[model samples]
Target: MDPVDYVFTVRTGDRKNAGTDANVKVILHGDGGRKTDKMKLRNILKNDFERSQIDNFTVKKQFKIRNIEKLELWRDNFGLGSAWYLDYVKVRRKDKDTEYSFPVFRWIPAKTHLIFRVNDTSLPQQDPEAEQRWNELKRKRDSYIVCQKITGGPAQVIKLYCSTSLKGQVPKRK
Candidate 1:
């Protein structure tokens, strides 16, 4: 078997697909998250190296993004406790332009995963997306792709999971 190497992936709460809508948002560090942010990343990278997966690993990483918005906290109290939303937008438009006023729900500061890929050299950048690396990372962040822990022997097979939701469905609605 080839020596294993780790690929870091920053996963979001929303599941991923080629057409999945990754509720992307700018993540402002929370009270505790800010403190351990560096530690968590450090451990994640170190664990791989300790395991001897590859000769050398990387530190900086990011994923593709379809969209993103700065988050503003929204407070709602229902019975037991209050809830905060970081992914929502208030919009105003001219009636002549068919203005619709509503709070658009969004996802921001998403759950991230350190996805690993094994390779002998750095990953190649496709010609088409070379110019839009930041956007691509946003897309990748929106879609949290978690690697399942393989408890058994070698993974003999691989599977692809896609969603059936009509709203985020890809292919561009006409």
Candidate 2:
């Protein structure tokens, strides 16, 4: 979470044509290249998915997710035919002493505390619908503090929770 080197936007809106939209919070914690993480975030966000935690009610400063989206990491350069992208995500929920998978995209992070946000752009190529959703996400998003390490040059390792949220949905993949 080093001031967010990058972000992936997943948005929606109140527009009649906006269709069905969901916002899921995904916890992306693991060691890999930037490409892997980015690709996962985008694919999952645009897919049907969910992230459920084991009801460990941690105090989150009195906030609620009006919308939840499971944002998997994705790549900036979706080159070739190797896009693993998001297929399906399942939220693990339990009731009556039984665990169930909810087909919701409020994807929770593997670990708690770490945070991220969807990338934003004002370029003309950006989708109009996505822009609107991004707007809504920014209007009602939340953040948390996590001890994450942002690696760079050997002596320039940065540490902090560069956490934020996205405000849109992924355009149908091209």
TM-scores of the models, in the order given: 0.17, 0.17
Give the residue spans of candidate 1 off by over 4 A.
1-90, 94-97, 100-106, 110-174
Tens digit of per-residue lDDT, candidate 1, span 1-174: 222122222221222211122222222122332211121212332322111122222222222111212112222222221122221222111112221112322232234322111111233463322433455466655554333234443422222243333234232211
Q: In angstroms, how far off is 113's CA in candidate 1?
A: 21
- Model 2 Cα lDDT, one tens digit per residue, 1-174: 221222223332222222222222444332332211222233422332222211221112222222222323322222222212222232221212222122212222222222222222234355444654464355334332222232331332222233222224221211
Model 1 CA lDDT for position 84: 22
Worst 10 residues of 2 by lDDT: 52-61
Candidate 2's C-alpha runs over 4 A off are 1-72, 76-80, 93-174
The Cα error of candidate 2 at residue 170, in Å, is 31
RMSD vs true structure, all candidates: 22.1, 21.5
**What TM value does model 1 have?**
0.17
